[model samples]
Target: MSHHATPVPRHRAPAQPTTDYDVIIIGAGSAGLSAALALGRCLRRVLVCDGGPPRNAPSPGVQSFFTRDGIKPAELLRVGLAQLEPYETVEVRRAQVQRVKPAGRTFTVEAEGKSGRTFTATARKLLLATGVEDELPPVPGMRDLWGRGVLHCPYCHGWEVRNQPLAVYGQGKIVTGMALLVSRWAPDLVVCTDGPGHLSDNARRRLRQQKIKVNEEPISHLEGTAGGQLRNIVFQSGEKLARHALFVHPHQHQRSTLAEQLGCRLTSKGAVWINKHSQTSISGLYAAGDTTSGPQKALLAAAEGMEAAIAIHETLTREECPK
Candidate 1:
């Protein structure tokens, strides 16, 4: 099986790649779409290519953005796209960028449309806002529950499942801290190590003091409804712990290898490395959102995209359209 499934893409044909754009943004999530908006406002030629579903597509609603709080993820994108309608310089295509490489001062991107037709485009600057895919632990039904009853960030999902029976699925020192953080909303909490006992004495003591139960047994599977609503965690020893919600620190990797193929440096944590302006190690190439090494949130991604767009616009204007 594939490591993870990408989110579904919107239905659209690849835009004719006849003209070289000022900027090509390789994601249509908050980051890519926001960058397109900012660049479009500057009257720059922009192309946004959405390969697949956004990272939060499975979630019921987005959080933490002012005014947009609790808005559905797809709805947020719809609104953003509608706002870009008046910008004639901006174009969006539902295509997967399969490869990217520098060509002179510009970059060439090769993409394929939904109909399996291939197209090539060039950009003076490229933005790799392609987000990461969460790698859930290998337990039956775990993937199905993700973004539903099973989640990662407490800040994003804690309020919804607050005061419910929650469990933290992980192991080792970091997970101990994760358990503590999740306990803020889940007064009745449990930590399942899912393997060997690695929690230090102090961590165990802290969990005990907080009245959190720790289970060291490895998980066999999760029992849940067909719709992915988690109900219970089954252990190797045949014990079952009923839980209304679960939180885990899922390992993530970039959904696309375009950055890696183009020689962009990545952090030790597997995120694209970026500078102050959100530019990656490669010049004229930038990245933002969950792909970059930082706090991952929808609002933060949009802000980063705007920042990167402003920087890119300034640089392009100074070089190409200066007085």
Candidate 2:
């Protein structure tokens, strides 16, 4: 019998806090940590606050990332945090930032630590690396099997269950496209429209021509194994379809309310609008990663963080220089 070893969990040790810093990062995920490394390399006083669960904490491993492909999501973060240890200028705190307020040229951020104590810190610039939250379907047992059997992006999870009996949980017109996308991995596909969708007659005709099954009956619930691995789809009519995996298009929103609280402009897709340099509409505040518009990937988020950090550093340098 072949045995697989379980990866050890890594924890971030809290660092002593100071009253002021050059840059205050609101998240400690890929984007925030990457930005901290960039700023710390420049010897800028930076503090990173990590409050809640990481978005990819449930994912088994990251994919398509150069060199780090197939690495466990938690392990990748552990490596990133470890890289920051050499820089004394970068301080990390395991706390959730409760609120952020603009104070003249600086910003005041209030955060609550794990100990139930609240504290405040002021910074010349702020980076909102807080990623978005995936809103799973309200179907029973769906949330439990989210990253496992109930998945979102096709590029992310399609290959894992490739060639198996697959189904797309289509809820809207947008999901009609997702159903087609998933067809690339599993030819034997079915589009389960939980209810009547916005799909036009032409789209329905095309889907049928492709021989993909479309079931519009409301889903009663998802049946899964004890480990949350999907087994079958149970419908309102008491009919069940054997399926190994389910693809879904979920609604996403910013994990933190700080962006909305700051009056930052949002894109039509509901993400924070950011310029090429990752600067938000509000001066002295910037954003990166899933909070901003674009494809959401760990490597891409890290690159965006690097860009934002450089922009923040240059802007601060030009202003602080005695001209």
Candidate 3:
């Protein structure tokens, strides 16, 4: 299938001012689409709002996803959206959700389209699959090489760069941990603290035991090839360390504030906290994928979405049956 094919058809008309949808999914990534598939199969009305490109858009392809491994990120989503077409009860809108308001049991969502048109949608339950945003280092050339030479997840990009010269960017115990983890893929690894690694004696010993070199010099900037692949790490002292790839554990924050807007509890890491059923602290509000805590992977996010849908369906069933 052509990757350029329209994932979801555009709806020119405004959403009706009624709470007709059983669930309002705020994201159209793997998680949201998986939930829609489950809910749609259950004969429930679901509205999935496509909030534009996902966090992994910069990546060339999705890794470690069973069967679909190495598929382009956009192509994976296009396949997901295409699969939902058979379910008439499921509708997808390409809009940016701005705010979510709670009305007793139901919830009201306000979103704006690309054409500057605004619309309101209401549903009995809300699912937030909105992912997180990676805050890359301020060093030059970092963003340009993101998902290419500057990768964060080892499992996702390690094999491709295995046995190649690599570097882990961070400081203190975090960098220590990352260096050790990344060493499994590349024996030739170094830790670039960018000045003052803040490492404990034990941490340094561990890294030394692993034969990982530590560089405390502040990085002047990263040098990359014309194709955006990392070439070397240039230090302030005018020294350059040749490296094929650099791994980092960048800080992250929620991509959307809808969870906070609806008063959902959040972990210290800023991910939406959820119960076993994928329901958030607030009743009837569900969250899955990178929005919630734990390992962030496409396959795992899809599983979480399916679990959340099953729970939501059971909850709705209980309400209707009234045992």
For each candidate, the alpha-carbon lDDT, in order, equals 0.90, 0.88, 0.92
| Model 1 global lDDT (CA atoms, 0 to 1) | 0.90
Give a tens-digit lDDT track for model 1, residues 1-323: 65787877664443433448989999999999999999999999999998878989999889888899999999999999999999999999999999897876788989998888989999889999999998888888888888887989998999999999999988888788898999999999999988886888898999999999999898999999877789999999999999998999988899999888888899999899999988999999999888998889999999999999999998886665424
Across 113-135, the per-residue lDDT of candidate 2 in tens digits comes to 88989999999899999999988
| Cand. 3 TM to true fold | 0.93
Residue clash pairs of candidate 1: 7-53
lDDT of 3 at 313: 94
Q: lDDT rank, highest first?
A: 3, 1, 2
Q: After superposition, how far is residue 1 of candidate 2 from its true place, in Å?
A: 94
Ranking by TM-score: 3, 1, 2
Q: Write the per-residue lDDT of candidate 3 for residues 204-235, one digit (tens) a residue.
A: 99999999999999999999987779999999
For model 3 the local lDDT of residue 60 reads: 84
Candidate 2: list runs displaced more than 4 Å. 1-19
